[model samples]
Target: MSTTTTLEAPNTGTWDGGNEPMKASYGKLMMWFFLLSDAFTFGAFLIVYGLARHKHMPYTGKADDFTFSTEWWPIPEKVYNAFPGLHGMDLPLAFVALMTMILILSSVTMVLAVEAGNRMDKNDVQKWLLWTILFGATFLGCQAWEWTHFITGTEEGMLLADGTRIFGANLTMNQYGPPLFADLFFFITGFHGTHVLSGVVLLIMIFINTVNGVYHKRGHYEMVEKVGLYWHFVDLVWVFVFTFFYLI
Candidate 1:
């Protein structure tokens, strides 16, 4: 007597990890994973910020006695009023709004670059990518100027009850309500600024490679698409930062 044996076929789905899931290449998928993890980091920072703000927010009562006080969370509009070349004009969010617009425009240019890449239009891709880099660099410069203004502070910062004379923002103190405000400001914006700077560098490198016909030689412009994903992520994160840090 002979025993009959049946052999099952091997699984051919993503469980085998043999195919490009979602039609994304390994590099693109990895870029996405990196962005997702980075998003969680930013989210945690923002969540902490929210909790701190809630915990430290000044108490309010009796509208008649309610007065603008340094004890409360610093009003973003009042804090960010100064615009470049407009000394003491009280512009109020103008510079920040401009920065936001600049970043958004750069995101748009990145979209165009990716679109041009899809067509394999090297010249157009180069043009759009260069514009994106310029905008990003300009935004960084603006942020540096803003940081300088913040650090230097006004001629005299708000006086405290103890009369300790808070000058500007540092790790230990802030002219604003709580030191944590400035701490989060520096950490969050500084982190985002670093990302922008890095994106600019990456754009420069990809620009050079695009000119050198690297992508053309490869018969595709997936490099531009990959970097574009990063660029777009940076821009999206800025929107959230702006909402939480500036608008809120």
Candidate 2:
């Protein structure tokens, strides 16, 4: 008598095995997921800004009349024309453009650091990481300076016909056309600056670990690659922020 045996099929529902979903490590995959969610948040913020700008933009026949009108939005070029050390010169978007370049350079250094890690070159990794940190710090410093300048109003601020002198920007008031403009500027740029600061801190910790030969002992520089991914993401987000806030 011949008997047939039944076979059991493999379970593909739950991922219980040691396989990575996309060949990415657990930490890197999680980082990617977090970045994806964060991208949605930024997108929402930018969309709201666009809608607000269109709704509140000046449509009056006289452009000069709507300079300080609450119903109109301030012209970005006029507001951000001041530059460091060249106070009287009208250099619109110069400082912000420099900040963007600094961030891009930092991303390049991050790439070099990741490459060094792949080659197991600890010294080169440290050098590149240090450069990246310096660039990040410089960018943060520039932001702080810009914020201070914005808070300190110009000599002749937006003076209204009602004799209400709007000096500087705050949560409730702004020397600019509308309070919403300042509000969005503070919220969006402040959020991005916070991310840059956090990335710097993370890079510092990773730098310490690299110095201590942690990854070297592990025989892989996956940590550096992971942090590089984060750094690149931050840089990419800044590009969008710059285009939305400054360029557009």
Candidate 3:
């Protein structure tokens, strides 16, 4: 007697999006997807910036010797050489360096907040989150100052070919080098700044919730982790922006 056994159908429930992949929660996975998409957007913007900069050769001279010219790309150091208190000084990248430090420190505080969240320490979470917010606000203030200086420009100003004397950078003209430089600067930096602002708002929300014991009642701090991911991403993007837009 030959008995044939029938094979049962494979279980489809696990594959029906019912189970979390890689042991990650649905919310965490969704956050990753969103971040991946955002990365692509930022990557495209940076790539375009790189290609455009490559197409136009940057000035290969001293910052002091550099002149305003649309024909060639302006050196970043020459363009961003204004200091706050010490006006008229040729401190290239000083203010930007400070901004970078402030942002990085904010990222550090964010990490601490996430760690505290993971440990279920609500007090520490609130403390670190507040620090992160303060640092982020400081960074934004620095950026505002930088923008003001960039717009106000040097007292000497640049004389255009058409007998127009412009002080700083605007959409139509740039005292630095090419108008394209200023355009990309505003768009890219402005986009990043908006992200920072959003992150700060989110942090404030999380801080309020923590103070009110919302996450404590829920028994998990996953919300903090999600915002932490976003904060870290913003900080990481700035590093690249500083490298490409400033140092390069």
Candidate 4:
């Protein structure tokens, strides 16, 4: 007697002919293509951010207050308030650090989940996927906190150096460092957050399947790998955010 085995190209309806030498499943190949396009989107965004920084920002503080070669935009600390009730704390970057660690950790957990799936260890897969989901959610919570703190300063009214105030207003060009800065911040981060939010939902779906023995019945877990690719992409985007938004 002879037996035959077949491999399914995951997350796609296409039947594999088993002769295409590229060999990866449809899900993974699509992830690679999506990442390529995503890279271009981020490049465009960073390019614009660079352009914004080149134009000298209006400075309220005396020249001595300037840092980073005396030509940088307002110190991120002065512009973005991260710690609540820590007036003049000079610690705006700390929250971003937390956000970064959470995302990176989530990526690590995702890899673990993929490994567990490869080993056909259903219990381990479930465990690692839960951890991945938790870390991703924590990052989202931190981002939500960061956004809230930045939008609402301690004074209740947005106050200028000379005591002028704007209240209940999204920081505009005249209000915040630059209108474009605020706009780009919202667009990029919001887009990224929405991705995280979707990843969480998909993870939940996969978790439920694992619990219900979907992979067990199918005899494999390529679905987990498909989702892991998306999880990693979200983490990669935050690397850009940390570099461009916080570092330089």
| The best candidate in terms of lDDT | 3
Q: All models: lDDT?
A: 0.88, 0.88, 0.90, 0.76
lDDT of 1 at 18: 53
**Which residue pairs in candidate 2 collide?**
none
How displaced is residue 168 in candidate 3, in Å? 0.6
Residues 146-244, model 2: lDDT tens digits: 998888767778888788787878888888768889889898899889999999999999999999999999999998998898899989989999988
Q: Which digits, one per residue and each the tens of the lDDT, describe model 1 over residues 70-159?
A: 577777776788998989787878999999999999999999999999999999999999999999999999999999998877766868
Candidate 4 wrongly placed segments (more than 4 Å): 1-18, 56-72, 84-88, 156-163, 167-175
Q: How many pairs in model 3 have backbone atoms within 3 A of each other, for residues 3 or more apart or on separate chains, i.e. clashes? A: 0
In model 2, where do residues sit more than 4 Å from their true spots?
1-21, 59-68
lDDT of 3: 0.90
The residue pairs found clashing in candidate 4 are none
What are the per-residue Cα lDDT tens digits for candidate 4 across 1-248?
55877775555335555355578977788888987898788778878878887776646567455432223355565556456456666665776777788899999999999999999999999999999989988888887877775556445444556776754225464234555666777777887898899999999999999999999899999999989988898888889877887776
Stretches off by above 4 angstroms in model 1 are 1-15, 59-70, 162-164
Model 2 misses residue 47 by how many Å?
A: 1.8
Per-model TM-score versus the true fold: 0.89, 0.89, 0.91, 0.80
What does the lDDT read for residue 171 in candidate 4? Answer: 41
Q: What's the count of clashing pairs in each model shown?
A: 0, 0, 0, 0
lDDT (10s digit) by residue, model 3, range 52-163: 8999976777757778777789778778888789988988899999999999999999999999999999999999999999999999999999999888788878777899
Give the RMSD in angstroms, all C-alphas superposed, for model 4.
Answer: 6.1
